[model samples]
Target: MKTQDIFVLGLTTFALFLGAGNLIFPPAMGLDAGTSLTSAMAGFLITAVGLPAFTIIVLGRIGNTNNLTKALPKWLGTTFWVLLFTAIGPAFGMPRAVTVAYEMGIQPFFTNDHLVAFSIIFSAVTLFLAFKPGNLVTYIGKIMTPALIILLCGLGLAAFLSPLGTPAAPSGDYQVGAVTSGLIQGYMTMDAIAAVGFGWVIIHAIKAKGVTTQQGIASTSIKVALIYAALMASCYIVMGYVGATSTSIAEHGVNGSVILTRYVAGEFGHYGQWLLAAIILMACLTTTVGLTNACAEYYQDTFKASFGFTATVIVVLTGVIANFGLNDILKVSLPAILVLCPVAIALVLASLAASTFTVSRLTHSAVLITATLFGTIDAINILGKMPKDLGDFFSDTLPLYNAHAGWLLPSLFMLITTAMIGRTASAEKKFGRVDYRLKTANND
Candidate 1:
């Protein structure tokens, strides 16, 4: 792809990932972290920006989401794909975007009574834009994303020029293990899951730009991921700084939207409020459009449904779910997000390793299975569904259990063990009653 085309694709990728949690979580974390902002932000950037970029790079080599679990059985792959797409689509992600936009952008200016009308209008616009999935790069990357960036940059500049106050001392979880706290908080963004879902759109976009070869696709994807990471990291740092310094103006423990609103209003007054409103609306709208398009396409291809019908259904579902309010949506979604994120991380890492090493299907399955088992236990504990004694036992026995990531070590161990076993089996079969040099030369 040409340099300009790559740049545009990068903007689209950035916009697609910059949705509800991306806008909210960092500021709230920064507020809590305060003096510990550097360590907390470091952990936040790892999962929020780094994981998603790494996911894109892996998918670029492996092909789209359908290829993600190809090593598994057909039924298992389909089930995993369905769950992943649903989690990042109409079920949680898309609705969360609508609610965030409504709460932050429209609710502050208007009354709560306007939620129904706002949802309808918001979904309608998303539906219209999503109807032409082919034009997403042009519509979002070329147009909406630039405007959103400009507004965000303005807010960032104001935050930098004027000081709010010295950051307060770190509190609660941030008082200790701030990095782990931030890393867990980053899971709320759900961008890694979105990256898997958005892989098809991006690959198609690159192909549309005449990059059809696997090497070309992977190369372009790296460039896009770098650009996306740079933009996301900058925004997170600026927003975290704004939140950290706003203790004098805004109270702690409030949602990030409120903290940001207070900071912007204090800095720029009424006009600044409007600027924030514009920024939230644009960010959420682009994400909703990209998600709707990606999900609708998935359904159309997988289930043989009509694209228009699927799009309409997804939009309507998102609008209805948005009425549940942001806090409620987040509360309900957290358990599921917690369960899926570790598994997604494991899958990304396994895929990367498979691309480099001679890995077997059993290795991939074992790693993911370990991740899923532990991840489910973590979710159960979080939801208070597990027995207190059992939960405490696991927490005490498992490393990083307090961080909501008890699955990592076990998954890594499973990968290494299963990979070694597979390699041994292959070696034995190849060396059985045969000269290694003769076989190697014949194969070559």
Candidate 2:
């Protein structure tokens, strides 16, 4: 609860969420987005910085996290977590971590068939880490992140000194819809969903310090969570900008991951590339471990009856599927991330809404269910395996899906409707009129 404790714990929490996206995705986006990259970066920051930060605060305030979506109606809540966690793990999260590692780490050594090797090794290690997650917080959060940071700092500094190339023509690439692209890349960060995943770990870390009082526990948790959010937010913006300015190096026709690695190598040479590779791999390892651990924890929690038995199964299954290849994981996960991301955004907004109803179980659940239905439909469409009739029905009947933004309006509508209901309920219960009492803290 003390300010100093907040500092240390905040660093630990931030380190967990600062995965591959926090380190590499933004910079790649910035390189591609170019001048318009800033706007896109801004959009990226909304979900990346804003949502994740809000999640920490919400979890801290509510002091309860059965499941991020489990707060919703029964079937819907289960659906939400399954979709979110699955998308992040086997489909996307773990895959992305493997990707960043290959791009940054193993590629230098075994660039040929690197994707194949990267997919296998990355998944294998993450499975190994999660299979025995004992002291993972200490092993990963304490040890790995520091090394990851050193590597990133070196790469970041190298890029700063020599520069890679001028940023791409952002005005053209990002012009069509800079905001949307940035927002989409922001989803790549997965900070908001991570909040739910990391919330309990943080709580336990704090609770271990023996702060037992309810009020005291929340106060301390918020201070640290907020700080962690800020640290992560800074990283997102920097990487995005780095990506934005990488147009000159495009001639190499490099893969997105190669852009930064090449940039580092160009500036620092062979030894620098080796260091960069190590850092990139380590950074990704930290993230990969976090994702597997989060998914495993939830699976174990959901199947408490099986406990160790079930956790082992979940880890093994994901790792094996991962061996199918990194590209496979990315291809499958794209739809899931695109589908669930909007609903995730809606949850963050509603969770942080000033109104008690928006913040309450009743309203949050109602809104989440509506969004989940739309998101599921949207996801089905993207992944391209939907039942013919169902897909046609949602598209024909739903005005929004035609634009590929089905979840947006529905989520907003739910929030407004639920807020109105909450307002009415609040007045009836004598919880007072909206007096505009506010809690202020800068968050993503």
Q: Which prediction has the highest TM-score against the true structure?
A: 1
Query: In terms of TM-score, how similar is model 2 to the real structure?
Result: 0.78
Cα lDDT tens digits, model 2, 1-444, are 566656767766777776655666776677667767668877877867777777777766555555345556777767777788777766667656665666666666763665765566666676666566556656765667666666666666656666667766665447688887777667545566667766656765666677767577668867876787676777666566556556665532345566666566566777867876776677667666666666766766665535355445555555566557668777767766765676776776676564234344566676667777887777777667778888788878887674455777888888887777767776766643223222222221
List the global CA lDDT of all models: 0.85, 0.66
Measured on C-alpha atoms, candidate 2 has an lDDT of 0.66
lDDT of 1 by residue, 1-444 (tens): 789999999999999988866777788888889999999999899988988999999988875556677788878877877787777887888888887788888887765478889899999999999998888899999999999899989989888889687789998998988888888777657677788888878887888898888799889999999999999999999999988988988777988988888888899988878988899999999989998888888888788989999999989998998887757876877677777877887887787777777676697788878999999887887677889898789988999776667888999988888777877877888787478688888999
The Cα error of candidate 2 at residue 339, in Å, is 2.8
**How do the predictions measure up, each by TM-score?**
0.94, 0.78
Off by over 4 Å in 1: 324-333, 433-444
The list of candidate 2 runs beyond 4 A from truth reads 2-5, 67-71, 111-134, 173-181, 251-254, 305-307, 330-333, 348-362, 376-406, 422-444
* Distance from true location, Cα of 244 in model 2, Å: 4.0
